[model samples]
Target: MKVVSSRDFNQDVSHAKRAARIEPIFITDRGRPTHVLMSIENFRHLTGQTETIVDLLAMPEPRDIDLDGSRPTTWDRQAKFG
Candidate 1:
């Protein structure tokens, strides 16, 4: 990773960002690391480690739905009594 002083960061931000693509760029303040600049793709790939709701829905259902309607369902039986 490349390290840039806070003062240099403002003057050479474009170069610093280009360098960050290969790895991370550390922004230093008084010789101490303060922040990091990374590529969006890398950031998303690292943060998108969990399964989203859309991904879960795209998968198959857990079990059969029993959509036959041939069996006497609750509504069918209730109508006879009521």
Candidate 2:
């Protein structure tokens, strides 16, 4: 992981771009982390969106997912409901 202050990042954008390939580059503001820069491959891996259901599920159903119940409704005493 590489960290870069916003100033240096702006000064040397190329180095930051190259650093993003190996790992993520953390951009900080006032010593606090502001943003992260990562390679597209790493981003995909981190988000887990690239994996197919079959690949993620592996064996069988991971969990029993169902939505058989109807949507619930909430009403306030001052509000009308039909």
Candidate 3:
């Protein structure tokens, strides 16, 4: 892992980004580590994160949903006569 001060990172952001592709880069502020820079693939792999619900919903519907009156679901109900 490469360590760089915030000033250095700010001065050469491009270089830091390039180095991050190879390994994580630690960014420091006032001599203490503040953040990390890493490739998106690496980050995802480390976190094991998956696509969110919004992402799934945004995708085109793969099949048509049947909402015909032929099938009644549990929600269907009737009022009993007094």
Candidate 4:
């Protein structure tokens, strides 16, 4: 992990970005940590947003769904609308 002051970060944004590719970069303001800079891959991993098609396919199939195929009666429609 790398810690950079806000002033230093603003001065050399590219360096911070490069460091973030390997690990998180902490940006500080007034000598306190304020923000983190990290690669998009890391961000997605931490947020659990890195699902692939294989992951989707690996989920267990749903079961026992019931469907009603009957058409609604005219009286049922009228009662619903009123």
Give lDDT tens digits, candidate 4, residues 14-44: 9999999999999999999999999979998
Clashing pairs in 3: none
Candidate 2 residue lDDT tens string, 5-82 = 999999999999899999999999989899999887898888876856776678576476546755346546565553
Off by over 4 Å in 1: 49-82
CA lDDT scores, all candidates in order: 0.85, 0.84, 0.89, 0.89
What candidate 2 gets wrong by more than 4 Å, as runs, is 51-82
lDDT of 1 by residue, 1-82 (tens): 6889999999988998899888989999999999999986678688985667887799998686777776565566567777
Clashes of each: 0, 0, 0, 0
Q: Model 2 TM-score? A: 0.58
Q: Per-prediction TM-score, please?
A: 0.55, 0.58, 0.60, 0.60
For model 1, what is the C-alpha lDDT against the true structure? 0.85
The pairs that clash in candidate 2 are none
lDDT by residue (21-67, candidate 3, tens digit) is 99999999999999999997798789997777986899899686766
Clashes of 2: 0
